[model samples]
Target: MGYVVPVRANISSINFHWQSLVRRPMPYEISFRWNDPEAMDEPRANVSYVGYVPRVESVFSVLFPCTGRVSAVVSVDIMLNITTYQPKQAIIFLKLKRSKTCLQGQPTPLNEAANDTVRLVLGGAEQDLSLVLGVTGAIGVTFVTLGGVMMFYVRQRKAALRYTALLSCWSLEPEQRPQPCDLLGWMQDLSASFDRLI
Candidate 1:
């Protein structure tokens, strides 16, 4: 049978075998993993690498599918901050995991899907970095400055103290916390936390 995919789908419902039909996405890194009950906090794909986009050509890739009941599409969508300079690589990868047991498993994509899915898409998009930055960045800057002023009025907000509280509850041995974080980028104040951690 043939799988008809939309131009863009939610990053949560991706499958590995659909690589061929996938539209070339943002030039982002990709990795895949099987579900794992033991290490819910760590990435099970055990694969990590950077992606480079010479020309954002049409994208296609075929891999195994998810074995477990729930499906997830792990992706990174970055709109570049610089004009004229494109990202190195941008694509999404499907990682498989079991929802109930949280165990990791891998299923292969069908042959036809595999054959049709892996090409990169390239060309200039009608994106206005200036507008995005001007609007979103302006809002962020306003809130941050306002927040700083508010912080002055309120009690001290100690990030170190709060993060310590989180680490204190996390088990060294794996157990599924209702919301486990496999993606470090998805963690709470991860960027700032990293600054504190190191």
Candidate 2:
């Protein structure tokens, strides 16, 4: 028999299986109990099958249904009832342990025996970073470009203000005021002298 329950977000499902090593057909019933007392209402199933080979064993697998996110470690107690030639029934308990990461499609073996638990790992949803990176890069480039334009504009305004102040100072001396053409020629001479000195 088998039991099914909701698994955590990281885990997609759990694959549980058992094998009968006995030579004859064995009637078995399996039940599951969770560590959490609140999850007492777990699903269980029964099976009746026989073992034909001595060393070889038949494997029976079941998937545990996953529902919501599980943050803590979940411990499951497996109880098995095997009916043999004797009138009395034999009970066996196998402990299955699961963590949040184990459910992410990674196959985890519970026991060393070949008939023990084998988990199947499921891949989580992939996140797209291309769009986010593109947008961020675009914003950064725009900000840098805007800062450069503003700096250029401020430098141009400062230079124009300095030139205006120099012109006003020259105009204040009415007796020494130079003609517009002479002023242009004087500015060119001053620039040529500065360049030669440099």
Candidate 3:
């Protein structure tokens, strides 16, 4: 997640709070880089917490030049880096405030600012794997049931067609009728075909 500041507004300071929810003590770090598409390359901003620490609440008062034009909106990219092996979660709160001089020779206060919070989770792959397997098994069972129903429908259609053909043949005149032995042989052949299909 990222935050956008107003164009041409001076970014005087950025404050952040980092907390870890791991039972055992572990080292962690946070840093951010500026991503400007118009520039040749993104430049990294220096914050206070480069070294590894368990938890930190830091503020950076470095001057950030607003390169955005009057009518265009520019964004800054902030990235956080955490180093830990065990399953853990962290809550980060960030605030960006600016101060400037007004037309009446007055210094505006830092009343208006951009604020954001983020929650990071790490290492929960086992639960995800179980969920995926459950969904896959359900899909497999659905497809197998659908296939059985389709096969049953096809068999019924074939039997109906054979019966219809027999009835049409029997409707013919007596001189053109099929013999009883011939009808019996045809029925036997149809049964054998159905057995083979099944």
Candidate 4:
């Protein structure tokens, strides 16, 4: 049998988020997570209490078998004395299950938003908000450009018809037809005339 990693009272977990858009430091939430509810209800491990074996490293782990479930439980140990701030901690028990067939013992699902999972939205403070917003805006622009390119490619098969129609109009000389499309306008000043059809 494997041994449980120890947790102590003074010891705590820390998560920090910095948002550059609003130039602010988001809230820092500290907490705990473990494989077994029984094991986590009362933290058995902390800074002072080493487990069955003394580990010189700053980090330790405890693994839990999930039976036939898709996700595995995990516990990571860290020293509590290194941080300046601490907060109230709470544990959430998740009993919700998957509707589709799930593989046994897969890694935990950690998307940006997942129910019954540990998620903290954090970022920089007001001073850094501009930076964050800059990055976000850049990303938004890139996505728009990509979407436009995709739309163009998807419509490429039909674009030939539109191009052919325009060519037919421009091919006639101004003198040969009634109100011919001003070819000189296209050859000399395309930008001014192109706006009509665009």
The digit string of per-residue lDDT tens for model 3 on 63-132 reads 3333232222334444455555443455434333222211222222334343323233433245557767
The residue-level lDDT of candidate 3 at 120 comes to 36
Q: Could you tell which candidate, 3 or 4, scores higher by lDDT?
A: 3
Worst 10 residues of 2 by lDDT: 119-128
lDDT of each: 0.37, 0.45, 0.48, 0.35
Clashes of 1: 42
lDDT of 2 by residue, 11-74 (tens): 4333444444444555555566655433222423323323221123334443333222333345
Question: How does model 1 score by TM-score?
Answer: 0.23
Candidate 3 runs further than 4 Å off: 1-122, 189-198
| Ordered list by lDDT, greatest first | 3, 2, 1, 4
Off by over 4 Å in 4: 1-166, 170-182, 186-191
Tens digit of lDDT per residue, candidate 1, span 1-198? 123243122111222221122234334455433344232222222122444334423333423333443434422221211112333343334322222222245333234242323333333343445556679999999999999987764433455554564575474445643255553533546546554644
All candidates in order of TM-score, best leading? 3, 2, 1, 4
- Tens digit of lDDT per residue, candidate 4, span 101-168? 22344422222121122222222234356756989999999999999998787567346545664577
Model 1 spans with C-alpha error above 4 angstroms:
1-27, 33-48, 65-124, 128-198
